[model samples]
Target: MDRRESGKTPRQLVPVVLTGAMGKYGGELWDAAERDGRIKPGRGPNFTKRVLPDLAPLLRKDALDQGIPRSAVDRSDRPTRGVLIPPEEGGPFPERLGPCGWSSEDPGEFQWDIVTRGRAHWLLARDAVATGWLAAAMHGLPHWADSEPVVFFSTHTRRSARSRFGAKFRTPPADLVTVRPDPLFPELRSVDAATAAVQCLSSVMRGKKTW
Candidate 1:
């Protein structure tokens, strides 16, 4: 429910939409992503990497070692601008790579990496703040469930921004959302411990159980 599945445009993958890079195809896609840090060593990139709201550029930059395939795009099927196409999906994942090799994804954390957190940076407004369960995860809390939807609170995003990208967004009193650099990834941020705790508790008490 939190994913960006709305709008009349086709959000699913289509050929030549992104001028895809010559992706790894079969297992190579994951391999390439891992090699480029688009994904983690033993974990996939969610392939959408909504883990941090600002990770889109970092993730996209980590990829594209190869060039995207060229093809004639049909005018009737041209993708709408500003659409939320998941990364990699728009790439050259052609059947050619399908026969390259036999490989299997480690099912263990695949969903957590790929689905639990979508491409948050693209879906969220640039100034979004990680809060609630996500803040706990940012703080390195253990036993936090990945099944829980990532949550955020932002004052800068438009009111039209919906709860998508595997996360929920809210506008709160500006001072209530104190932020600090994420201890794990200093480049990103999370609500401070107290703020995270309060927000997490507030969600729980309010029965906001969409996740």
Candidate 2:
């Protein structure tokens, strides 16, 4: 019989809840769990397969209304070569451009640029719901109520902050940890965010050091 069932104090087990499980960052967290032999197949219907398709149209429309051009929408059936605007001479242009084509040139413009990308929108919408589901599941798990679970978010933004999923982390019980690699280490930064998060979590779990 389980110790808890026999009136013994339940062993404390820290459960790691990864928000962007299928995304680049979440994938790293999953891998980290695998290395620690803590990986388990997620329960319930696949969120991406069963839920995302139905929501994609609504999300796509929202993106369009948010200034994202239809052309930027990612389509599974075709390739999307995104637009790239060259930097103006002597203008304040960022040295590097992100996947969504935004740079450090203007914060306001960069914010819009991010929402306009279909890929970005898709990822955001999916993550929003996935985290919600994770939160609910964690609440239902045994002994979870007694300890706070670590939630790793792949990314966030001002807009996402207002989203239901984002709001969850912003508020209570969930210990939200944004997994980012140290920028000073170029090699580490080059790796996926998920991998970096895993490394950091591993370090913390081992009580070796704080991230």
Candidate 3:
């Protein structure tokens, strides 16, 4: 039963990582960075004149004062790996909900409770799953891999028994890929997603990295 001695070795890392959809996704700025080679091959640090100073001291001492051009920084040499969900696309289905729905005469007039609760449950789970992924990264053994994969669960239309719980509430989904049904996005409510995403990356860096 000693498989380790039988000419097999344990894998050093897993390829997939989960992050919050709301906070990590790329936006106009990231897009510009990608276009300008600031993030060179998606491996180097972001280089804005403003941000460059914050990162300059991070360079190893031997490399410091070496007269090396910023462009000469080897991008493919970064130890950690990452992906983003972008501000526009992240959240409880950002594309689906609009301001018009919530501003009507009756907030509950359209049986939107079911949708809202579904969105909350999915987002909460997403936060939990992202935290676990980050915890794994904290071990310092993971080598980030690059890939963007999206999976979705079956679409279901169902009514919640506790729609009138006073505040938002709903049944949680059994799967991580399920979509959130709600459209309302509150800045304060989104903090959990942001926090989990930060944990995912910060844990891996032992708190050295801040998102």
Candidate 4:
């Protein structure tokens, strides 16, 4: 069994958590864990980027110009936010186009941009939640295949995108546990579960150094 999973093993991994531009605690945790040998960091920021059909030519030309292929234009220029269309009662896609187009409404069809190694930013955090890696990589939450227990930290004062995303998507059971408000000083918390998270992080570091 992995060190974190086995009670015999000490907590080694100490992954940090972050939300895009609002907060960056995850990076702080990573730096601290790296400096101290007892703690190890795991997981990096994961994010999603919207993909949409480009309409620059559509704006420039009132009518189709030279019959340019819809797929030939650059999609990267599309807006990042705003609804392109309204949801239909029983249609695959809405009938109208908004700023971002159809990709803005459907979560499943929304293209996800993920990064394996990078700064733990808000975009990454959102993507991690969207992709099912936020808790495990950031807060020592359990993996779907693991039997080890998990603990969750949340902003109790208010609902957050992460919490909402998990609820909307029905976050995996193993990834959910006791969730609380964002700690004023998360590093100062003392709990058995917290200790386990630290030990698990340590184990994660030990394995990383060898590789």
Deviation in Å, model 2, residue 153 alpha carbon? 8.6
Compose the digit string of candidate 4's lDDT tens values, residues 78-139: 11221111111232321221121211122211121111111112222332221222233223
**In model 2, where is the ten-residue run with the lowest total lDDT?**
48-57
Please report, in order, the local distance difference test score of every candidate based on alpha carbons: 0.39, 0.26, 0.25, 0.25
Better of 1 and 3 by TM-score: 1
User: Per-residue lDDT for 21-137 in model 3, tens only?
Assistant: 433334554455345432224243222111100011123332334654444333212211121111122233211112111111111222222223223233423332212222122
lDDT of 1 by residue, 90-202 (tens): 43333322211111221122223222142344233546666776665454332233446555666765443253333556776656645553322344456787776776677
* Sliding window of 10 residues with minimal summed lDDT for model 4: 111-120
Q: Pick the candidate with the highest lDDT.
A: 1
Question: TM-score of every model?
Answer: 0.43, 0.18, 0.15, 0.18
Off by over 4 Å in 3: 1-19, 41-54, 58-211
Per-residue accuracy of model 2 over 14-132 as CA lDDT, tens digit each: 22233333232223333443343222244642221111000112344555566655665442111012222211123232112112121112212122221122223333333432122
Clashing pairs in 2: 25-194
Better of 2 and 3 by lDDT: 2
Off by over 4 Å in 2: 1-59, 75-204, 207-211
